[model samples]
Target: MDRAALPGGVLTGLWQRARLVERRIETPTAVTLVLAPAEWPGHLAGQHADIRLTADDGYTAVRSYSMSAPVRDGLVEFTIQRVHDGEVSMYLCDDLPIGADVELRGPIGGWFVWRETETRPVLLVAGGSGIVPLQAMIRQRRAANSDVPFRVLYSVRTPEDVIYGDELADSADGVETTILYTRTAPAGSGRPPGRITQADLKTHGWTPGFDASCFICGPTGFVETAAKALVAMGHDSHRIKTERFG
Candidate 1:
């Protein structure tokens, strides 16, 4: 069920004024917003926030977006991928002005989040903008100065579609990052463009025997395919967590 359709009392209590303090262009179609909320209860790495936009005509649209970075002071940040014909996303990525305010409620989703105290190895598989939350986990790991082993497998249509490309390149210090271009591989690339498969997971992902915690996020189809591949690679289903969006 859409949270917006629920009884107002259920969500109203969590909504607070969030002012857009900073904006960044992530890709041609994506934008990142840094907001300062009137109040915030710190959030876990993979959690998300719900933003509500109401027009003068009383029409309202609400959408959930994953946090892109760990909280710094009283600020929180999330990236918006402009969805064609998306009421909320289009406004957020193209029209929302700096210093403008929106009703924000979050620190949502506890099951898929990653905590700094976790010591086990982590396997992060992302498809397209699904990297948002996984990126948060990576940032949090660095912020906490954790040495936990992390391996990231990111699948995108092309190099141009990769989000946080520069930062991901710099994440090689302790994190092993691999980009698998599904449609257009860059020149001189060793692997041809293709969908993620069991071989890909076995070669790049943590071994099933390592007892790694796996987080997979993407569109429904992509998430399902990746999760299935992991299970086929002998990973315990219980150790896998997934968060998917359209």
Candidate 2:
């Protein structure tokens, strides 16, 4: 039997009615939803799923959200930032109740994924909610017992705005993690409070000699700026992979 065709519920309906099984508060303004498949289907880390919701009037809104859980897990998670006017986000954050059925189709997109075969040193740059996919990569790498050196530079408006702060800190036990807070002052040693600049990368040990593979995710402006900087630093443009959100 094809794994894809297994009784995972109607692909279209499982794509539609996978309810919000759990929710957790990340930051004051952010929430993470754990969606369980009416029937389980595995997903790959670093991939995203499309979530759709129907209105009482039969209208629907759709949005793509990156999965935060490790691929092997039966449950899928999405860390969402509430956007005032965003239809899906607003629904997920406010109106969607625990156990309320929701629609999703996913384990989608392969371009941004990291697999065991990728042996090069990695450098991840993310801003705001863009850290979602990088979180998956971090978990997958750790699970595979991979020794590949990797680093992440996460930029946020303030310390409070940093998503997965505790998880990222714990994950940094061996891997490098740098947090740049643009709106707040640096709390103590090693924390840089400002927007990401070329100098910030240098201070974080991003050297031209590293020959690293770069993965950048964020808003259009953030991705463009980070990619250009990495390219100017002599990193091969072909080795840089980017996923821009909005």
Runs in model 2 deviating more than 4 A are 1-16, 171-173, 189-192
Per-residue alpha-carbon lDDT of candidate 2 for residues 56-119, written as tens digits (9 for 90 to 100): 8999877777787774346778888887787677678777899888877866676777886688
Can you write out model 1's per-residue Cα lDDT over 140-229, one digit (the tens) per residue? 999999999999999999999999998888865588899999999999879999998888899989999999999998888989999999
Pairs that collide in candidate 2 are: 13-16, 15-104, 16-103
TM-score of each: 0.94, 0.88
Every candidate's lDDT: 0.87, 0.76
Write down the lDDT that model 1 would get. Answer: 0.87
lDDT of 2 at 81: 80
